[model samples]
Target: MDTGASEVAHDFRPFFRVYKDGRVEKYKLIDHVRPVPAGLDPATGIETKDVVVSPETGVSARIFARTAGGGGGGPDRKLPLLVHYHGGGFCAGSPFDSTSNGFLSAMVTQANVVAISIDYRLAPENPLPIAYEDSFAALKWIAGHSDGSGPEPWLNQYADLGRVFIVGESAGANIGQYVAVRAGVAGIRVKGMLVVHPFFGGKETDEMYKFMCPTSSGLDDDPKLNPAVDPDLPKMACEKVLVCVAEKDWLRNRGVKYYEALCGSGWEGKAELVEAKEEAHCFHLFTKSERAEQLIKKMVDFITMD
Candidate 1:
């Protein structure tokens, strides 16, 4: 009797959907931009190039280096290396997304560091530990170049491997933290980690994680997503950590809590927390507000400070 009504179904939602047949459908919530070719960015004077980190997995990255006579007139000596990861809840987004590309281009000029923005495999298709693995692979590739023996010339000529820093926003922050942990385990030294508006989770976000990574731990308190619950957080590769949050962001408390946990973790490292007054998540990336400029300045100071 009710067979007629059951025959019709609904699909297509904001982020993604799981159908009765186990098919996953993802919605395009934002526009994806093609990455520009390797060359000088006239507006920011940042030279960018894309390189493949792993040919088998097709994982690649966009590298940004400031051109001579660019912002701050370029550094007189080698610059610190900043490896960045973009955020999209592990289901969407890319290093070439306009917002990410623009912000990173400016960041390379502002921080005067040679930056590599990772393009990791997304979820539901590739899933959880895959992105983490890709990120770690990229990290190892960079580390291999520490002695100036790696393939990339920009890294060898301009990047100061000893002062390597890792930075990411939102879900990328989550990945960055894991990368730092793996680095520590591998004896790879990192100068610091900067997590901006990290996208952490509770029960609600945990459901999203499950949808994106069906094979994940499926628990909100999983150490990978909840660093506060991670016993080995003190073993993170970097001795310095900067956690940034915006006042109006829903995830602000998570960042604050992360800062507090790191401070009390007996990690023997310095952890600092910064709050952007009256702002939302990742405001600096999308808008040219005063706080955004402040963030850029703060990042520069952190990257260059002795």
Candidate 2:
């Protein structure tokens, strides 16, 4: 006589589940938070709108610009362009998610820059380089408008295209880094890149990568997941790179390794690492602690510095 024990012995986690036949199930962990529609966020005074980056691929982005001088015209000064990517292990996450929305709102106000948070395709359904490709496509779309002849009025009137920056958090950071690399090869000029708590691979993360990006090399040392292993580190497009890591996060070592590798890569660029002591991965997106505030300030300074 057998029981139903075998049926209950599955590995259905809260985020995602994988079956023996290669079927993947993803659960909506934060579905309750709706994306804030385009307009002025009363709390932060930042105006935002959504635009389609690529209708063919169904990729879009949310643009955030700081409202200036009593919400009339725009800021007195032209602002830098920051193209940001949000993280969810490349399996789940959206730029319109509550955390991402809130952070971008604050960042635009603090950094005084025009930001476009990319809504790239996720994986396990779209797979690995799909997200990377979508992000790079978004970069091209932004660059296409650099001559002030593009359709987007806000970017045309206010965005300083020559001072563009690429930024991301966690898995998004991973994507942003790859996009920056491609930018170098493609001759797209970017001012800098900032990766906050980038999601990198280890022995355990390698399994997740395999499931999400089955077509890739799927090794922990895959250059897509581990920049330290990439031979093109010296070819990064930007002149400066800022990598942030949390002291309590398990992935801190990988972030540090990336920074060290970039510094030693003879990359002809400046690389800096800032460690948030007593914090875990992406703490600034959740908690409003003093440390989180410091991280925001640091990011603002990094982007605005001469």
Q: Best candidate, lDDT-wise?
A: 2
Clashing pairs in 2: none
Q: Give the TM-score of each candidate.
A: 0.89, 0.91
Model 2 agreement with the true structure over 1-306: per-residue lDDT tens digits: 444432332343556776555566777766555666788777777888888988899999888876556332243557888899998888777877788788887778778788889999987778878999999999998998788888788888778888899999988999999999889888999999999999877654466677667776666678887777888877889999999999999889989988887888878988889999999989998888999999999999999897
Worst 10-residue lDDT window, candidate 1: 3-12
Residue 92, candidate 2: how far off, in angstroms? 1.5
Write down the lDDT that model 1 would get. 0.81
Cα RMSD to the true fold for all candidates: 3.4, 3.2
Candidate 2 lDDT at 301 equals 93
Find the 10 residues in a row with the least total lDDT in model 2: 3-12
Q: What is model 1's C-alpha RMSD?
A: 3.4
